[model samples]
Target chain A: MAAGKPVVMVTLVSSDGQSFQLLEEAALLSAMVRDTIQIGQGRGPAGIPIRNITGQTLSMVVVYCNKHYTAAAAADGDDAADEEKKVANKKQLREWDEQFINLEQDKLYDILVAANNLGIDGLVDLCCWRFADMMKGKSASEIRVKLGIRDDFTSEQRAQIEKDSPWVWSRTT
Target chain B: MLQPARENEGVWRLSVWCFGVDAGVQFSRCENPIFPLIPSMAQDGGESRDWAEMPSDALSGVFGKLNASDILTGAGLVCRVWRQLATNDPTLWRRVDMSCQADLVENMKAKYAMARIAVNRAAGTMEAFSAEYFVTDDLLLYISTRASSLKSLHLIYCPYISIKGIAEAMKGFTQLEELTLYLSSFHGYVSEAIGRAGQQLICFRLNNAFGYYNCPVDDTEAFWIANNMPELRELQLIGNRLSNDGLIAILDHCLRLESLDVSRCYNVQMDDVLKSKCARIRDLMLPRDQDVFIDSDPSDEGYSYDTDAMYDSEY
Candidate 1:
C-alpha cells in the first residue's frame, strides 16, 4: 500500500453469515482473500464469503493479518532504522505471535486448519510449532492425554514400538 | 549383539500396508476399499480432517518442527494415522539427528541398528546426518551406501569413526556443504579426502577438546581445508593446533571466508598483520573473546553433559 493511496476496506463474510471488514492490504495476507479480491468479488454488498472458516476463527485470522500487516508496513517504512531497532521490532512481533498463538488444544486445532485452508503459511507454521512445543519432552501417553488424542495402538503394537526404540521413553529428564 | 533385520518387520509391515492401500487406489480410482487391519481411515471422502484425521500436509507441517527423538517417541506414536505418517514420511528423516540421544542407547550395535532404521526411513533422500558416541566405521559405511544425497555430516565424540571409514564415506557425500567434527581422532588425510570430494563445502567446524590445557596444535588440518575447500564461508577451528602460519594460509587461500571462529586456538596470536589479514571476516572470534566454546566438564570420556549441550551452541 503506497502512501496517500485510499485504503480499500473489504467486507469478509464467514461461514455462519457473520461479516467482518478489513483493509485490502491486510486481508491480502490470506491467499483465499487475495484470490477473491483478484476476481473482483469483494466489491458487493454481501461481501466475500470465506467458506469453512467460522466467525470466531476468521476474527482470529483477521487479528493476525492486521497485526502482521502493520508490523511489516512499519518495517518497510523505516528504511533507515538501525539494525538494533529492527531486531527489537522483530522480537516484539515474535512475542506477539507467541502470545496470540497460545491457545488450548481445540482452539489451536481450529486455527491450524483455518490457517491452512486460508493458505496462510506463516500462521500454519506458527500453529505447528506451538503444537510441537506442546508435544516436546512428553511421553506418548502424556502427549495423547494433553492433546486429547486416542491411542488406537494395541498392547502388542505399543510394546513393539517401545522395544524398537527403548531409549526414546527411558530418558531421565 | 546385532539384532536380526527381521526385528524391524512390524514397523515395515505398517508402511507396506499404507503403500498397498495407496497403490490399490491408484490401480482402481472408482473403488474406495478399506483394508481390515487399518480400519475406518475415511480419508479422501469429503470428510473434515482434524488433528486425529490430519492430511499429509498438516501432519508433515507438525512433524517438520519436531526433532528426531520427539518423532521417535511421542508424535509418531500418538495413533495409527500418526504412526503411518511417521513411517512413510521421507521428509521427516532428512536430517537424522541421533546425537541428542546417543548416550541413552546402551550399546553401539543397537545404535547402529537404529541408525540403519533412520537411513532406511529416509529412503535415499537424507541430506543431513548428525551422530555422537555410538557411530562406528561400519555404520558410516552403511550410511554411505544409503544416503547418497547427504549434504551435511556432523560426527560428535564418535571416537570409533576412524579416518578410513569417514574417507570412504566422503565418496558418497559429494554434495556435502557443512562438515562438523567435535572431539574426534580424524587426522589430516580425512580433511584432504573431504577437500578432494566435498568441493561444495561451505561451513567446516573441527572443534577439538575445548577448555583443555596444553592441547596439541598443528597446521595440517588448516592447510588441508585451505588447499581443498576455497569456497568455504564459515570456519570454526576451536581448540585446534592451527598456528598463525596455518591461519595466514587459510586467509590467503579461502577468499570467500565470511565468519571465522578460532576461539581456543592458542597458537594463533592476534598480531597486527594477522588481524589485518583476518579483517575481511565479518564474525571473527579471537582466542580471548570470552572463550564461548569453553565447556567446564571437558573430558576424554564419551559422555560429557556440557558437550551434549554444545550441540546447539553457535560455532
Candidate 2:
C-alpha cells in the first residue's frame, strides 16, 4: 500500500546503547511501540530507549517483526486475492517462523521475555507454543530436566500431588 | 532515499540489511519509537532469572496450549510456582475438559479421581465442563454442589451416570446455557428437570447411536425439549427416533430456533408442510445429510461415540 509513499522510519535504542532503525509499520507489531507512537512519547531527538533488552536480543526482535510485517504486507497485496495463494503464503510464513524460532534455550528465553515486555502477542504465543511442545508427553522430571527447572518439592509435597491425582503420574498410553 | 543525519543523530548510523526472499527491507528511522521499560517476568525471580519463577501470565500462555493431562501431571509437578498455578488458578480450571484421554480410560477409578481433582481446582467457579466415559452419579452430584456458575456441560458416553443423577444435577445448573449428551441414555425425569432448570439454555444436543435398525419411532425426548426449552437457538437430535409429530411440536414451541439437526433420524418424514414450517431455520440438517456426526465426539482418539447398545428403543 505504501509502495510510492515515503516510508516512515522509527529508531529504537537497545539497553546497551545500540540504536537500530526500522519502518514504522513493522515497529508497530509491538503494542508498546504502537501505544508510544499514538501518545507521541517517542518523538525524541534520539531513538526510544528499550530498557532491559540487550542490543543482541533487540536486533533479533527487529528482524522478526520486519519479516512478519513484510509477509503480512505481501499477503494483503492485490496479487494475493486468490484463496489458494493466501493459504500458500500462510504456509510459507509458518515455515519461516519455525526456522526463525529454532534458537538455543537461553536465546528462546530472551526472545520470549522481550516479546512479553514489548506486548508482542504473536511472538509470545509462538514462544509459549514452543515451550508447550517441549513439555508435551514428557514427565514432570523430564520437563524439569529439559527446561532446567530445579526439583524443589519435598517428599511430602510430591506424595500429596501424586495422591491427589494418580492418573496424572501413570502413563495414559 | 538516504536523508542527512540530524544533529542529535551524530552517534547513530542506519544500516540497511537485506532480509531473506524480500530484498532491501529497511529497518531504520521512525518519528516515534517504543520505550518498553516494563520489567520482564525473569526479573521477578531476581538477577538469576530462573525459569521456574517466571510470572503467571507467561506460564498461563503455555498452560493454554496444554491438555488436561499435561496440566495435571507435567506442569503442575514442575515447580512450586507452576504447581501453585495449576492447582489454585480458577481461570485455568474455569473450563475443564477431561474428555478424549484414551489412555486415561483404562483406569476408570483414577480417571474419576483426576476429574474430581480438576473440579476442586476450579474452586466452584467453573463455567464450562466436558468429559466422557468416567463420569458417575457421585461425581455429577459433586459438580452440581460446587459448579452452580457452570454455563456449558458436555457429557459423552457416560454409562455410569444414572438418570436420577442427571436430574438431581440439573437442579444446581440453573444458569446453564449449552448442554450436550452423546450416547448417554436418559428418560422423562431427566428431561423434565433440565427443561425446568435450564431456562437460559440456548443449545441442546442429544445424539444417539447411528444406523437403520436403531430406529424406535419415539418422540418423547423431542416433545420434552419443545415444551420446555423456548429459548433454544440450536437443537441437534442426531440419530433420534423422533417422528414428524415431534418435529412439529419442536417447531411450534421453539420459535427462536435458528438451527436444527435431525441427521440420521429416519423416523422424521420432512413432508413439504413440515419443510415449509422449518424454512425459517437458517441451518436445517435433514436425516439424509452426510457426515452429520463429524463434530460429534471430543478430540480424543480411542473412545468413539458409536456404541451399538446406546439406545434401547423399547422404552
Candidate 3:
C-alpha cells in the first residue's frame, strides 16, 4: 500500500512453509493469479495457500515473476539508460530461462504437475514442450518404460497392435 | 525264494528277463541349480513385457504433439487405440496445407475430404483450408460448405477459380483474416467481391497471373485493391502492371502497410513513386534491372522523378 510499491501483491505459501511475494503486474501474467487478486480486495496484503507446489517449484516461479516484473518496469521508463539496461536484462533473462528448464526427468515431471496445479501457462507449456521433445526418436516400448506407463493390453491385443504397426517394433533406435 | 532246478526253469527265467526289459527302468536321480532358476527368469521377463504398453490417454497426449507428417506416417497407423486417439485430437487438423502438390490434385482432394471428415468428427470444425490447384468451381463451393470456421485461405497456381466462386466462398467466411492468391486469373470483379465481403483482410499477394497477357502495366487490379481493401497491411505484386498512380493510391490508403514487394513491375519507378508516397515503408522489394533516378529540374516531368538520386543514396 506504500506510494512507490506495486498496487497489488500476492503472497504464495508452498507446502514446505516457504512463501513467495509477487507484484500484481507480474502476477497478472497468469489468469488464475489475476482472478484471485480481483476476487480479494486489492488494498490489503493477501496470502494464497498453494497446497500442490513445493519450495523448489515456488522459488522458480517467483524468480520468473520478478524477472518479468523488472523488465516491464524498465520498459515503461522513458530514460535512455533504463531502456538500454532493460534490453540487456531481457537477453540475460532469456538465457536464464533456457538454463532453468534443463532439469532431470523426475524433477521435470514434478515441475509440470506444480505448474499445472498453479495454473502457470508459460511454465506448463515449457514443461510439456520439453517432454514432447524427449519423446522424439524413441520407440513405443522405450517411451512406455521411460515414462513409467503400464501395459494394459491382452496377448491377443498386443499381437494386433504389433500387426497394425510393425514399424514400431522394427525401429532400430 | 528258491524254485525247483530243471530245464523248464531256464526257459521261465529267460521269459521273466524279456518282460523286465520291456517294462520301464529307473536311473540315479540328481538336482541341477540352473534348471531351478529358469522358471523364475521366464516369469520376470513376462512382467517386464507387461510394463511396455502405455495407457491410452498418455499415448493420445504424445500423439497430439506430433506434426502432420509424423501423425500420418507414424501415429495414425500405430494401432487401433492410437488411430482413435490421433484422429480424436482436433489440433492435428487445425491447418491443412495441400499447396505443395499441385499435380496430384485429385488425390489431394480425396485426402482433404477424408481429413475434413475426421477433423469434423474429432474437433467439430475445420478452421482453415489451403490448396494449390482449383480444378472445378464445385470443389471451392464444397470446401466453403465443409469448413465453416475457415479463417485463412491460400490459393496458388489455380487459374480456374473465377470471381463468382470467390464471391460465393467469401460470403460464408466473415472472420477471414489472411488471403494469399498466387497466379490467379481473376480481374477487377474478384477485387470488388472481396471488398463487398466486408471481412478485414490483412495481407494480399498477387503474382504474374493477375496482369494482362502482354502489357501488364495496363492491369488495374492493383488500383482496385488499393482503393477497396483499407485494412491491408502487407501487399506483394509480382510481374504485375502496377503504375505510379496505383502505387500512390496504395500508399495513401493502406496506412498500416508494413512490407511491400513489387518486383518485375516495369511501369512504377520505385524512388519516384514509393519513397515519396510512403515514408513508413520498411521492407521494399524492387526489380534489379531498373535504375531509380532523382530529377531536380522543375520544368521537366522527370524533375519530380528523383529515382536515380534516391537509388544512389540508398545504395
Candidate 4:
C-alpha cells in the first residue's frame, strides 16, 4: 500500500451470511482474500464470499491479521532507537498472540481450520502451537481424550508394543 | 507400530497450491474437524475430496515437531488413523533425538532399542541426529549401517560415546557436514579420522554444549581440524587448549571462517595481528578475559530458580 493512495474497504461475507467490512491493507493480510478482492479490481465494491469460514471464526482471524499487520509495520519502521522498539513491539505482540489463541478446545479447532482455509500463516502457526501445547507432557489416554481419537488398539497388540519399546512408554512425563 | 494395510494411505504431503491461481476449491460439511464445516453448496454425490478425512499436510506439520519418543510411544498408539500417519514414513524419522531420556543408564538397552526404531524407520534418509545421555559402541555401529545420509551428528552430552564407536561410525557419515561433540572426547586417532572423513564439514562446535563438563578441547584436536575440513565456516572450540601456533594454523588455513567461538580457549594467544584477523570475522566470541568480571562462576548471575523456591546456581 503506497502513501496518499486511497485505501479501498473490502466487504467479506462469511458462510453464515454475515457481512464485515475491513481496510484493504488489513484484509490483504490473507493471500486468499487479497487475491479474491484483486480479481474484482475496478469493477465495483464487490462483496467477496468466504464460503469456507464462519462469520465468528472469520472475525477472529481478521482481528489476528490486523494486530499482526500493524505490529509488522511498526517493527519495519525507522532507525537509532528502532531496533530496541522493534524487539519490544515483537515481544508485546507475542504476548498478545498467546492471549488471543487462549480459546476453548472446540473454538481453537475451528480457528485452526479457518486459518488454514484463509491461508493465513501467522494464525496457523499460533493455532498449531496452541494445539501442540495441549499434546505436550500428556499421557497416551490424555492425548486421545483431547484429540477426539479412539483407542482401537487390542490388548494383545498393546502388550506387544509395550514389550517392543518399553523405555519410550516408560516416559510418563 | 501397527502396519497399515496400504503403504501410503494417510501419508501427509505438503501441498504448494498457489493462492488465486487455483481458487477452484469449495467448502462443505467436513466430517473431519480440521476442515471448515460449511454446509455443502453445489452438492456432489461423492464424499468430500479431503480423502484423508482431515488436512493431512497440516497433520504432518504438527507431527513433524514432536520428538521421536512422543510419536513412537504416545501418538502412534492413539488411534488407527494416527498410527498410520505416524509410523508409515521414513523421512519422518530423519531426526532421532533420544537426549530427552533422563535416567539413561537404567533403561539403556530399551532406550537404544527405541532409537533403533527411528534408525530403522529412517532407512538412510537420516539427515540430522542428536543423541545424548548414553550411547555405546554397538549403538553407534548400528547407526552407521542405517544412517548413510546423516549430515548433522551432535553427541553433545553423550559421555559414553567412545572414540572407537564414533571413528568407526565416521566411515558411514562421509556426507556429515555439521559435527558437534561435547562430553565425548576425541583423543588418539579419532580426531585424525574425523579430519580424514569430514571433507564437507561446515559447522563444528565441540562447545561442551553449555554443560558443566570440564573436559579439555586441546591442540591435537585443532591440528586434526586444520588438517581436514577446509570448507569450515562456524567453528566453536570452548575450553580449547589451542596455543598461539594452533590458533595461527586455523587463521592461516580455514579462510572462510565466519563465526568463531573460542570462549574458554584461554591458552590461545591473541596478539595485535591475530586480533585484527579475528576482528574481520562476522560473528566472534573471543576468549573471555579475566578483567571483564571478577566472579568465580562466569556463566551465572543467579537468575534461575529450581523447584521448592530455591535459587540454583551451576557454580
Candidate 5:
C-alpha cells in the first residue's frame, strides 16, 4: 500500500506502558504483529499492545525486521539465481547476524524472549545458537555460573542421578 | 535516510545460520507477568533471567546439539530438570555412540540399561547405534525391537554376541547400510541373514582380523562374505588371513565393490594379474609388498662403549 501512498506508522505499546512507532511494513515483519495488523485491516486506532515485551526489546525487534527484510529482498533479486552469488549473499547476511547477536548474556536472552513473543523465527534461531554455543564445551556448573543460575539439585539427588546414569560421571572430555 | 537505515539495519537480520537449520526455533513461551521485561538497574538488586529457566523444549534443543556422551554424562546429571530432560528427550538420544566408556564389561549392565533408556527415549527415530564392548544377544534383541529404523550399527569387541542373535536382529533392520563388527571371534550365521536382508548395505568393516589370541580371519569368513554381501560398495578387513583364493573369489563375486582395505593380510599378493583383474576398484588398500625397514644406527652402539671407557680416560 505504501508504493505510491504516504508511509503509514503503526504505534506499538510495549508492556511497560511506553509506545514506539514503526513503519507498517517493518512492524509486519513479526508474524504475530503482522497477524494483528491484518486483523485490524489498518484501522486499529489504539495500536497493538504487546503485553509481554518492553519498550527496549520491541525497538530491537523492529530494527531486526527492517534490516532482515532489506537483506531478504536483496538476496531474492535476479543475481541470486547464480548459486555462488546467492551463497555469498547469505554469508554476508550471516556475518551481519553474528554482529547483531553479540549482546550481553541477559540482553541476548531478553532479545530471544522478545523475538519469541514477536514470533520472529530468525531471531529465535540466532539466540538458540548463541545459547548452545555457550553450553557447548562448558561443564554444567560452568554453564550455571555463566548463565547466572543456581544448582538446584541436592547432593543426595545428584548422587542418585549419577547412580542411575553413571556414564556422565566417567566422561572427562 | 540511507545512513540511518544502514545503522538500523544492523539491529535486525538474525537467521537460521546462527544456530543449525533444525534447532533453536522456539521454546514454549513462559511469560511471567510479574517479572518485569525491563532490565533493572544494578543498584536496585535486580534479578535477571536464569539460564535454567528456558522452556523444556528449548533446553532440549541445546542438549540435542551436544554429543551423546556429553548429553548423557555431561548435561544429564547437571540438575534434576536437566537430568530428567536429558533422560527423556528423544532428540538427544537418536544417535547413541557408546564406543568409549560406559561400554566396559564392568559397567555393562548399568550402561546397557542406560542404553535402553536412550533407545526408549529415541522410540523408532534411532538411526545409528554403536558400542565398543559387550553387545550381547540381549542388547541386540532389545535394540532391534526398539530402534527399528536403525541404519548404521557398530559393535566392536562383542565376542559374547552370538551370530544368530545379531542375524535375527538384522532381519528387522532392512534399512541397514553401514555395519561394523570389529575385534570379534569367528561366526558365519550372520552371512545368511545379511545376504537376505542387508541388500542396502554400503559399508562393511569386519576387523575380526584382530585377535585376543591372534587367531586371524581365514578364507571361510572371506568366502562367506563373497557369497553373501555382493552388494557391498566398501569393505575393510584388517588383520585377516584371507589367501589369494578368497581375494580372487571376492573380486569376481563383489563386482560393485569400489573400496577395499585388506591391510596386514600377507597371504593375498597384489600381483599384476590380480591388480589388472580388479582394476574397477578405486580406493583399494592392499597389504604392503615388503616389510619397510629403517636403517640401523651403528654409531649408537659405539657411543655406549665410549661412555663406558670415560672412567679409564679420566684416570
Candidate 6:
C-alpha cells in the first residue's frame, strides 16, 4: 500500500477452487489484467474470481507468473552477480516453458481457455504459435483429423471444398 | 424351486441391461466435451507429444502476420482451421502494393478482389488503397465500392484513369487523409472533381498532370483550388503552366499550406513567386538555374532574357 513500492500482489481464484497469488507487475504483462487492476484500485488482492479456468490450468498460469516475477526482480537489481543470475534464470524459464507447453490436446484447450480468462497474453501467444507450428506441413484432411473437427460438409460440399482448392491436396502428397 | 431360479435369472439380466444403457449415455455425453480426448488416448498420447489446441482468437492473431501471397496459396488452402483464420485476418489485406508486378496486372486484380472480400469480412472496412501501375477507370470504380472507408491512396503512372473515376472514388472516401497521383494525363476537370469530393485532404501531390496547355489559360485551376482544398498541407506541382498570378492565387487560398513543389514551372518568375507567395514553403524544388533579377528600372519589357538559364533547368 506504500507509494513507490514497485510491486502489488493479486489473488486469482479458478473455477475448480484453486488459488493463484502473483505479483502485480508480472501480471501487468497482460493488458486486460493490468486494466482490470487499475480500475479495481488495490481491491484485486481480496480475490478476483476467474470462473472459466480449471485447477490444472490455474496452476500453470501461476508457474508462468512466478518465473517472470523472479527474472524481472533479478534484472532490476544493479550488480554483476544479479545480471549473471538473471541470464541463467531466463534460460531455465525458457526450458520450463518449452516443457510446460507440451500438453495433450484437451489439456492444451483448457490452458488456452484459462490463459484467455486470466488475461495472460504471453501464454496465449505461445500456445497459438505452437498450434500454428503443428499445422505447418499438414494437409487439410490431416489437419481436420488432428483437430477433431467434425466434417460439416455434405458429400457434394466436401467435393467442392477440395475442387475449389485442389492445390491443397496436390502440394501435401 | 423352478419359479425361484427363473426370478433370480430375470433380475440378473435386468441389472446388466441397465448398466449397459448407463454406460452408453455417459460415453455419448463425454464424446466431444469442449475438447477431444482421442488424441491423448492414441499411440503418442502423452502431454509431451500430443499437439496443443489453440483458441480461435489466438489463431486469428497468428494468421494476421502472414503476407498476401502466403495467405492466398498456403494459408487460404489449408484446413478449415487455417482457412477460417486467414479469411478473418484484416491486417493481411491492408496495403495491396501492386506496383512491382506490372506484367501480372490482370492476375493482381483478381487477387486484389479476393483480398478485399477477406479484408472487408475481417475488419468490416478497407482503409488503405495503393496502386503503382496504370489502373483503369472501371477498376478504380470497382475498388471504390468496397473500399468506402479508404484513408490513403497512392497511384503512379496510371494513364487510363480520368478525373471522373477519382471524383467518384473521393466522394465515398470522406476520411481520406493523403492522395498521391503522378504522371497522369488528367487536366482541370480532375482537379475540379477532387474539389467536390468534400474531403479535408492533408497531403496532395499532382505532378506532370495539370498544366496550362492541358487546360484553357483561364482561371480554372485557381477556381478549383479556392473551392475544394482549403485544408491542404502539402502541394507538389511539376511541369504545370502555373504563372505568377496562379501561384499567388493558390497561396492566398490554402492558408494551412506548409510544403509546395513547383519545379519546371518556367512561366512564373522566381523572385516574385518564391519570396512573396511561398514564404512558408520548406522543401521547394524549383528550376535551379533561374536567378532572381532585381532590376533598378522596373519598366523593361524588352530586356533580353538569358536563354542559358532556360536551357540548363531542363527537368
Task: Write model 1 residue lDDT over B88-119, tens digit each, in one string.
Answer: 99999999887877345565665677688789
Restricting to chain A, the TM-score for each candidate equals: 0.87, 0.90, 0.75, 0.82, 0.82, 0.76
Q: On residues A35-143, what C-alpha lDDT tens digit does candidate 3 reach at each position?
A: 7777864334547766856665666677766776776676666456676676787788777777877764544555666666666677666666676666654555454
Candidate closer to the true structure by TM-score (higher is better), 2 or 3: 2
lDDT of 4 by residue, A1-173 (tens): 34787877777777766677767677787778877767765225557778866666677777887788777666655454667777787789999999999875545666777777788877888887776676765667657554445567677866776777766555422
Off by over 4 Å in 3: A1-49, A53-85, A135-173, B1-142, B155-174, B182-200, B208-216, B223-231, B243-259, B270-284, B289-315
**Per-model TM-score on C-alpha atoms:** 0.76, 0.79, 0.55, 0.75, 0.61, 0.55
- Candidate 4 lDDT for residue B226: 77
Give all candidates' CA lDDT scores. Answer: 0.75, 0.75, 0.58, 0.66, 0.67, 0.59
Regions of candidate 4 where Cα sits further than 4 Å from its true position = A1-3, A38-46, A75-81, A154-164, A168-173, B1-53, B89-91, B100-104, B186-189, B207-218, B263-267, B270-315
Candidates 2 and 4 compared: the better one by TM-score is 2
Predicted structure 4, TM vs. truth:
0.75
Candidate 1, superposed: residue stretches over 4 Å from native: A1-3, A153-173, B1-50, B100-113, B186-189, B193-195, B210-218, B269-276, B287-315
lDDT of 4 at B140: 79
Find the 10 residues in a row with the least total lDDT in model 3 chain B: B23-32
Q: What tens digits encode model 2's per-residue C-alpha lDDT throughout A106-136? A: 5577788889989999999998888787677
Q: Over the stretch A43-151, how does candidate 5's per-residue lDDT look in tens digits?
A: 3667788886766666677778778877775665646459988888889889988998876555677788777778788888888787666666556665554554556
Tens digits of lDDT, candidate 3, B51-100: 12344444444555654434543445444555566657776677766566
Determine the backbone clash count of candidate 6. 0
> Is 2 or 4 the stronger prediction by DockQ?
2
Model 1 pairs whose backbones collide: B217-B241, B218-B241
lDDT-best of 3 and 5 = 5
Candidate 3, residue A14: Cα displacement in angstroms equals 5.1
lDDT of 5 at A94: 92
Model 5's alpha-carbon lDDT is: 0.67
lDDT of 4 by residue, B1-315 (tens): 011122221221111031222212222234333344433321221223331245665566666767887777676666666667776777679887777567657866767787788888888889888877667778878888888798888875676776777778888887888888865454454456674565788988876422221333357767777778788999987756677678777877888889888875666657987888787689988776322433355335452224222112211
